[model samples]
Structures are given as structure tokens and as C-alpha cells.
Target: MTDTAHALGASRTLWELIDRRATLTPDRPVLIQDDRRLTFGELRDGCERVAAGLYGMGVRPGTVVAWQLPTRIETVLLTGALARIGAVQSPVIPFYRDREVGFAVRESKAEFLAVPGEWRGFDHTAMAGRLGARGVFEAYDTLPADDPSVLPPPPAEGTSVRWIYWTSGTTSDPKGVLHTDRSLIAGGSCLAHALRLTPEDVGSIAFPFAHIGGADYLVMLLLYGFPAVLFEKFALPDALETYRKHGVTTAGGSTAFYSMFLAEQRRRPGEPVVPTLRLLAGGGAAKPPELYHAVVREMGVQLTHGYGMTEVPMITMGSPDDTAENLATTEGRPPEGMEIRIVDGEVRLRGEAVCQGYLDPDQTAAVFDTDGFLITGDLGHLTPSGHLVLTGRLKDVIIRKGENISAKEIEDLLHEHPGVGDVAVIGLPDADRGERVCAVIEQPPAAPPLTLAAVTAYLRGTGLATHKLPEQLERVEALPRNETLRKVLKYKLRERFGAGAGADGG
Candidate 1:
């Protein structure tokens, strides 16, 4: 842990951290939107007032409040107010429709549902009502108002479960991942220490604030005393100006973000995409080693990827000062307290940063092993230097002719192909072979179409085994991705291509 993190040990809750930071750096900016800024002092005062207003509305400690708002300054304040009052907050992603929203609200048993009225041409208030949400109200430009004197004492403990974050639920209903102030603080501390950031560094939150990463990033800022630019809607060329305008020193959301920046830099060969950008760091999906080399070679910026999930916001993170090979090939190292146990090639975690469990008792019981380690479901191994190299998920293994083949091994090799903009390898059921390898690709615009023979040739040239070569190839304009983090939904691919057992491809 960094000295700052150790010194702030007295801050047991998120509200306490906010108060301490505000006291230490009252005038330092913590949040920045288009034309608005909120300093630490302003954040504390504003949130307290909002908390008082919520208190007036009978939102006391432990009250369940569900909010689905955009990434705006007000949303931050609302979340902070909930923290101040010790409310159990269930943050739903803004893009979720009735099915997801209804599931979250009902599962969390939220007493109040906060919406943005009609945002992005959708009536969230109406949807909340349709779901029979209690205390449905709009919290866009305005929030509740009352004097701060009515507010009770802030939360004193940090270990109590106070957050419920939903997963992407690609194949089934989203599961609510339970979290506490301490777990979030631990996750943030790992990120902050690994990145070696300072107060002088400016960051950017291009993803949704409702995502688990939002809290992870916010905790870093609170610890290091820095500010981040908020993007209501993040697009490549459009958001570039804001990044340049703010002199964003650190920016990245995931592997896709690195690809976008690299693409933008390619547009202007001689110029940097963001002159102030020095490092790109994020974690949610897998990172191709080629992508790391490409970002560093072309963008002239250090790219440090990490391993994390909704259950544990941060598990391992690459350090800025680590060896180049480690940064490129491994997911850095875990913090001092995080225990990584490799059981039968699967990575399991036991640490303070890890989430308490799922909202469903059955899920909680099933996910944790007897040793109290959360079964991560990811397959990986720890290097000699303690870095993690993920192979793939257990479910991602393809069984072919009594042999197990790793899909990620093929996907990583395919990522190097110039014709393949992005690719996903899956095993289609085959009566004789058990399963046949299939590759779904998204070709780059204006690039020559990719052929199955050409792909097989490239793999063969890479010295890949002939049996692992894709037997079929499917091309699409774009792959289906989850809303948050933009992770490709491979299950959808299986659904789309699993039926044809024996199909010829070019």
C-alpha cells in the first residue's frame, strides 16, 4: 500500500474518505464535466445537503435506493449523498430496459427509484412506474433539497454491505454482486498504487459511472487527490476534443478503448491522438499481447492492463514501473493482501478487495470454495515474478476428438492478422469430432475480405497445430457486445452458429 493509503486508514467509510480529502484539499477539483467542476469541498458540502434532503424524505441509514442515471455531475452527488446517509445503493446501468431494470429493482427491494426523467429519448420515470417501483422520481437537473442539520451521523463502519452491482447477464438474468466500503477501498487502493499516479495527473471516466469501475476509479482520485473528466456519451472522434481540451494525462476504459485511440492516431500518422496522454490502463475483458505492443509502438504511450471482474473490481494490475515484458505479457501483480490460489489451473481469490458475495444465497454458497476463496472461473497461472497470465475460461475450452483446445490461443494468434479487425473462436458441436473449431471475425473497413483458407494459412505459418485451425469462418460488420465495458458476448455467437454442424466455409 502507498503511504497515502496507509495514512488514510482512519477513513473507514466512503463518506469518511470524502470528508478527509475535502479537509486536506478543500479547493482541489474532484470531478469535471463539460463546463462544470466540483471541488472536494463542494463535493462534501453538496452531498451533505443532498443527504439532508434524502433524510427529510425518510431515507435513513440502510434504506434501499435504486438509481439509473447517466454519467453526470449530479449523479456523483446523488451517489455521495447515499453514502453519507449509509443507504444501500443499487446502481443500474442507464442503458438497461424494463427486463433488467425490473429484475434489479425487485431483487434489491429498492424503496426508491431515481431516474433521469426522459433521458436519451426514453421515459425512465414511466418505466419505473410500470415496474411498480416505489418512490419513483426524476433526478436529472434537480435533486431533493433540505437543510443539512437534519442529517444523522455518517456511517462509521465500512465493512457492512452497502452496494449492489449487476453483472452483464449475457446468458441469464444479471446477478447482483454485493460490496462494502472496505472492499471498494481495497480495490481502489490496488489500482492507485499500481498506476503510480499523483495529484498532478488528470484522468478520464469515459465509461458508465454505474459500472463497478466507476467506484474503483473514484476511489483512486479520492486517495491521490486528482480529478477526472466525465463523458455523458463517449464516442471516438467526438470525445477526442474534450480529452485534448482537458489535457487528459491518463485515459482508458478497456482493450477496445486502446484500439480506438490507436485507430485515431493512425488517422493522423505524424501527430499524437492526445498529446497529454502518457498511459492507458483498464481491465474488464482479455487483452491481446499484440494490442499492447501496437499501442506502445504507435501511440508512444505505456499501456498497463489489469485483471478484474464485477465481483472483485480489481484483482491484479500492471505497474507503470514494471518490466516491459511483464506489462506486455502478464497482468502485473496483486496487492499485498490479495491471495491468488491456482486450483487445477483456475484462478481463485481471497482478499479484502474481493466482494462479499452475490445477493442470491445460492450463488454465494456455490462461488466460494471451502478455503474462502472466490472461484474466479478464469483459468490462469502465476509467473515466477507473481504476474498473472490468463489462458482462458474453462467453458471456453473446445473438446475436439478427445482433445482439449484453447479458443483464446487461436483468438490471440488471429488478433495479429491484418485482415482480422476482431475475432472470436468457438467450438461448434460435431457428431464425429465432438466439436469443430469455428472463427467469427469482424473485418476492418476497406480491408480485403478474410477467407477460411487464408486464416488457416496464417495460423499454419505461426506454427499452430493443424487440428486447432478453424474449420469454418463467419464474418460480420460488428460483434455483439455487452453495454458496459463493451465485452464481446461469445454465447451469442454460439447461439447464432451452433446449429449448422457440418457447414463448408471459404
Candidate 2:
């Protein structure tokens, strides 16, 4: 496939494109909230005013602005404002508690912070107070009740940093990913092409605008002159309602979230059917084939899988016309300007999409091999047709008696079990062998207890390889996941199980 000509322009920067949209489509709906909406003109004015405010506060081209607001109009303005002023916006998911937020603020060395006054049962003021007291951030509340009007600031452009994001370190510490004006525009353009977004398309965003997925989708919508319905928080039902009410043509999310939402929606049927919805797109984690089938066959929408990270934003995305097998199994092919290769079962990506490197030079050097290919720790293989099929994490793969095991494969199979609610499989050190597969399970309140014997029996019945079957299984109240509902703290299980935990020990 050839790169789409519409995906890029010769000289237009991201800020310039946004300015053109605001100027050309001033009266058109740019953002829609429940009972309120902002036309392109209003959004532009808001961004300008916010940029002016930041400038008064001494925000400059290279400054890092950490934004921790819930989904709202402010998130839009803050993001756009930062882009216009050449300031780097580091979006932190609002759901992150103290430790996570503290880590982001400290690591990013944010000069300024923006958050809500109160949102979704969280006290924003207190959170802001804590961040402010930490001595690195200057926090501001985004409630419309206070400081409603502000001045429009002068444009800041050319040679300015636009955004900074953090990669989700499923197997290691989070690494900082930076984007300049050119790169961000490139990313948005790639996303627009991958999703085939158009001027008439409308998107409702449920994910927090702080992450790359959220920001990429938001910017793509704007760049294409499409309207975006912003959510202050994730409410599955509310999101569905928005889909129906707005006749949302597209939406973006993670595999886990889209699975949960699609599962819930399939259980009940009615009007507000959202027949207009063409694509339900997501990435970062592998989605079960059943979930993808349900979203397509049952719900009558395309469940497109994409592949990207904070380091390389939206590099590949499946098309609506993709085969069901492709949609369910692979992460599609590379987007414009991206080059991908698989060496020794590990995926390597390079191009404008690649990150500038981690905040720490040593860490950055460690992650990227020579020749500039990002040594994505993800274990994947290129299909005969060039599609990328993710197997599991390189560090997360379990080596049991010389047999390599994919934790994701086992976890996916476990999710099909009737009694299992959620699970995380990890590799723990073993004296007899290099490592052993251990599963930490979270069952529903009414579900019966799970045992190692039962798990092995289930795996056997499912026809999984004996080597891939978990040697140890433990039922826990819950597994530690991130705010995105992604399993992150699997190390805790290995810690508790101890290095030498055996099959019988569990």
C-alpha cells in the first residue's frame, strides 16, 4: 500500500493545521459535551487564552507542562494551548493516585500542572495541593466556576516542543517519549489515515486525554475537521449513550476496555443501536478473538486492532475491510513513514514515530539497539502477509524447562473459563529450571475457589500445550493493574511467591 498524500503536507505544522481548522471552520462544532458544545472558534479562543495564561506564568518553548485533568473541555484547551505555545504537554491519566502522579511529575520535571477542581468522586484540590507542595509543579483547577475569562496569548511557533508522553512499562520502568511540532503532526496524520477518518466523522472519547491513544484520537479528529464528544471520566453506560446520541462514527480505546464495553452492550439490545458506528478501534493489548467477533457480528461494527505505544504513537491500524482473522489476530501493517522488522521473535520499529529516547540517557541507550531501531521488548512475529502478530512480552515470557511459554496465551485461555474474572500469568525463578509459569487469579465474588489442579485440568481440556500450562496457580482477591486496567505489577506475584517457589509450593 502506498502512503496517502492527504496524510501530510509540505510545510504545515500541527499548530498551523489547528489554526487553519479554527479559522476555516469557526462555526462548526469542534467539541461536544453533555449540554454544552464548543465551536472551532470558541475552542481556538479558549486555547489562545490558556496559552496566554501559561505564558504569563513563564511557560516557554521547551518547558514541560503536566496536565492531569479529567476528560473535559479544559483538557482540549490545555492540550491545544500547549501545542500553540510550543510547550510540551505531558498528560497523566487523572485516575493515577499519588504515587503514579508523583512519579510522572518528578520524572517529567514539569514546570506547570493543570487539573480539575473536583471530578468523579476525586478531590482535585487536595491532589493539586499535594503536587504543588512537592515543589516541582504549579497546579491549576479547571472548573468553569472560577477564572472563567482570560486573554488570548500571542502565537508561539517554530522550533518548539509540543508534547511528552510515557510508555507503559509492562516489564520495566516507564520511559519518557517526546514529540516536536513536526512529529506530533505526523502522528496525527498517520492516525487519520489508519482509521480513515473524514471531515464528517464524529468521535466520542472515553479514555482520559492524558495518554497517547487519547491525545492521538483527539488531535486526529480536529485535524480532519471532525467533531469530538469529550468525557470527563469513563462511564461505560454514559459512553454508550453518547455513542447513540451523537451517532458517533468512530471511537478509540484499549483492548481490555473495549472488550468490557462490547461484552456489556451485547448482553442487552435495543434502539440507540448506533448503526452509524463504523469502527471501534483500540490497541496496546491483544484482544480475544471472541470479543472482536462479538463487536462485529453481534454489534454490526468493525473492531479494528491497532499497534503502537507512547514511544511510537499509532504506527499501524487494521482497516474496516480487514478479514475477521486479521482483525482478531494481528495489529495490521505499518503506517506512513514507519518501518518495522522482526528479529529473533522481537519487534523492532523505526521512523518519525520512534521516541526521542528515555529521560535517562543510559536507559534510552539500553532500550534502543544500534541502527536506531527501537528494541521494543514486545515478542511478535511478522505474518506471511506482513501483519504483526504479538505473542507476548520478551521479559514476560516464561522459560520452563527450556520451553518458552507466553503468559498472554495462557491468560487469554483463562479468560474463557466460566469462573475466572481476571488473571495475570508471570514467570518466577525456579531452582530446578530457569523459570516456571505462575498464575494469579481474581475470581468473581460468587465464583468458586480455583486451585492449581483445577487450572491444569482446564488447560488440558482446552488443548493447550503441557509446557505452556501454568505450573503454579494461586487465587487472590485481586491483581494489581494500572488505571488503564492493564496488568502492570505482576512482579508483586513473583516477589510474594519468592524466587524459588515451586509448582507444588503454590
Candidate 3:
């Protein structure tokens, strides 16, 4: 399977990968959604027809098309059509509003924009009109279609930047991440190799399809010739029925997703969440070592977490054959083509999967070093055996009285407590201490209320250092998370509590 996937991965463009896969197993199913099953051959035909329609609508080879759509077969088909047209495509998360959508389209100089007419009662067409976006059109259940002969030739080269993904706008407006078809194919190839998936295996895309991971997952389907269930709007238990219905073999999106499944499993002890589920794997957020163990023990499945970002979707991924200890403690090893170098505790990466650069050339210049390695602001070290263990982000280091404290270290310890459903440790501004450790927690149902003193006592009992104790704690109803991956927006916590916003403790 690896050899075949590698060969298919060599295809110059995404369209080429699709064409190759279609030729190999034209009758095999590739995408399944509520009542709709699309085979590989049908996918090719649909993409070409959609491409013809888009071409008739003035979409040329280099035309910039920005789309904001949900996870649906039509969405994937539209993306394929754009690829077939050799258009520079920029996808926006469906949840993004006026500011983000407007910024992305304007910044990308989008020649056309696609949106669902009125999905989930939002009236996206109206929103696009309000933004004064150009070439606005609806592409939901019914897409514009035409004969394939009307379209031009598909893109031949894969190195040109044809895909623009957005960074999580946790801080401000997201920078448009530039990716070539080859880069995406490389990332997906790393994933397909590491997971050891076969044609018999089924996957699921529970997250937003507009995310960069969407392409990575799509490339895997193309390479391995497998089908994945698409969730337009995924919710627990409700979506579990589809997982079971499709007999999904591999499932996971991020750490938040794993926690959701674990919480659901706890509802029915000794029962599998998804009976067919064998492995849970994902990246995009920090996975606590405790979460890894819980999923393994209670759910009766192997959990393989990886390290990836928008810049490089699959830098390192945990293989199913890795030792339990490595799976729990490390982020797994980089593949043959990936090069990892740690300088001053920062993880630097140089690999085919890495994106070309950001839309802002200045930002790109700042991120890459003289050696061309993308300077990941993440702080970590590689083990002797080549396993990468991330400590925390460079911005996550909270210094108090000349001593540096890792927020991830404290959060990991706090996650072990039964009373804590979720927690985020932030460094709040403190005049006396320069920066003070503050822990914000979300309480679970039926759990005892946690106080700052009780939390500090628990940390001490865990053999945690005295100075690393959180000086302040805030119990919130829920942690603020980005819509895409549910990654905790720590900056929001700092903004909320740093100004002495009535938090508990010193």
C-alpha cells in the first residue's frame, strides 16, 4: 500500500492524483454522506462537469476563486473542479463571518466567490452581497454543471501555489498560507504511510472541510483509494450513528475530538464508542498524556497523535506499530523526506510538505531561517530514538521571578484531576512577579467544585515544583476555542483574567 501510495503521490497535480485513482478503481466508493455515495469514476466526471460550468462562468486557469462552504460532496466536487481549471483556490471556513471572509477575498484578490445560498439559516449569499464580493454565486446541493469538453486542460505542474489556507485567527486576521499541490500531496503521503491505511480501511472527516487538513485527508483518499465519511455538521452521538453506519475504521480530528469521544465512552462503561473503531489519530491541538492512556484503556483502542500545522500538515505522525510509551510521550517520528532540527529549544522543519510561504512576503521572510527551515515557535526536543516531544509554545512560557514555567506542564497535571473537565494555564500580567501563572478550568458534571487552594495542593502532591503552582484560578463554563479545531484561545483567557477580572486566588 505504501509503494502504491508513493507512486500515486508522485502525480504532478491534485487532478492527476484523482485521474490516476479513478483509472485504477473507478467503481470503488470515494465519498459517502447522508444517502449519497460517490465512486471514483463519478468523482472525476462530476469534477470535470463542474469545471466546465465554472469555466463557462469566466473561471480561467489563473483566476482566483475563494469559496466558503460546509463539508459536503458538492464542496469537494467544487474544489476538484477548481483544481481542474488550474485556478488558485482559497477556502474559507463556513463559520467565518464578514471580517474574516472579506479580508480573505480582498487579500487574495479573488476573482470569484462561492458560498452556500442560505445554509443553516445564515443566508451566506446575503452576507457575500453585503461584503460587496465579486462574482458571488451559490453552490450548495445544486452546482452549475456543463459538458467536460468545454473545459481547458488540467494543471500540469504542481509547484505553483494553487491553494491558500488560513492560519487560525486566534490573535488577529489570519495570514493566507500558500501551498502547492505537491506540498499537500507530500503531507497526505506522510499521513497515509504513517497510519498504514489500506483500501479496506474507512476514514472520517468530522472537522470543517474548509480546513487545510481537508486537502491532506483528500490526498490520502486519492493515494490509498479509500472512502471517508463527510460530516456537514458533526455533533456527538448524533454523528456516531453515521460512523457506525459507515463502519468507519479510522476516526479523529484533534485533541478536543478525542476528549469528546472519551467523555461519550464514559457514559457507557465497558462498551465501545464505535464498535468498528480500531485507532484514533489526530493533531492540531495538544494531546495530554493522560488523554492518550484513557482512550487506550477505556475505549479499547490505540490512539496515535501527530504534530502538524497549517504550514506543514503532516510533519510527524504516530504509527500504529510504535511502542505504547512513545505513543503516549512523543509526537512520533518524521518520515524519510522530513528534516527536523532543534535550535535553542525551538522545533525547526524543512520538508516537501511545508507550504511555500504566507501571503505576506514579509511574514514569510520572518518565519523562515537562512537555512530555509520553517522556524516553528513551538518549544520541544527530539528523543534519542527520534521521537519528538513538544513541551510548550514559545509564547506559552510563563516566567515568574526569573524562573520559567511551562503552561503545558501545569495543564497536563491538572488534566489528571477528575474535577477538571478542561483547563488552560495562562501567564497573567503581575507587577510583583513580572508574570504570574494562572489556571482557568472548566468543571465537569457531578464533580466537586475546585478552588485555587485545592488545585495548588493537588499539584504539590503530584511532585510539582513550588514556584510552578498557579497563583490564580478561574472556573469558567467553557474554554474559548477556535471554531475549526476547538483549540483553546489562551490569549482570550489572558485578556479576560489579566486585568484582575474577579478571578479566584492571589
**TM of each candidate vs. truth:** 0.80, 0.74, 0.81
Q: Which has the greatest lDDT?
A: 3
lDDT of 2 by residue, 285-386 (tens): 556666778777766778887777777776788877677898888888777688887889888988875777777778788878888899978888888877
List candidate 2 stretches off by more than 4 Å: 1-12, 131-161, 168-173, 269-272, 397-506
Q: Give the alpha carbon lDDT tens digit for every residue of 140-259 in model 1.
A: 889997899988889989999999998732223567899999999899888998999989999999888988888998889899999999999988899999999988999987766787
Worst 10 residues of 2 by lDDT: 139-148
**Model 3 TM-score?**
0.81
RMSD of 2: 10.8
TM-score of 2: 0.74
Lowest summed lDDT window (length 10), candidate 3: 166-175
Q: In candidate 1, which residue pairs get closer than 3 Å at backbone N, Cα or C atoms, i.e. clash?
A: 452-506
Query: What C-alpha RMSD separates each model from the true structure?
Result: 11.3, 10.8, 11.1
- CA displacement after TM-score superposition, residue 340 of candidate 3 (Å): 0.7
How would you order the candidates by TM-score, starting with the best? Answer: 3, 1, 2
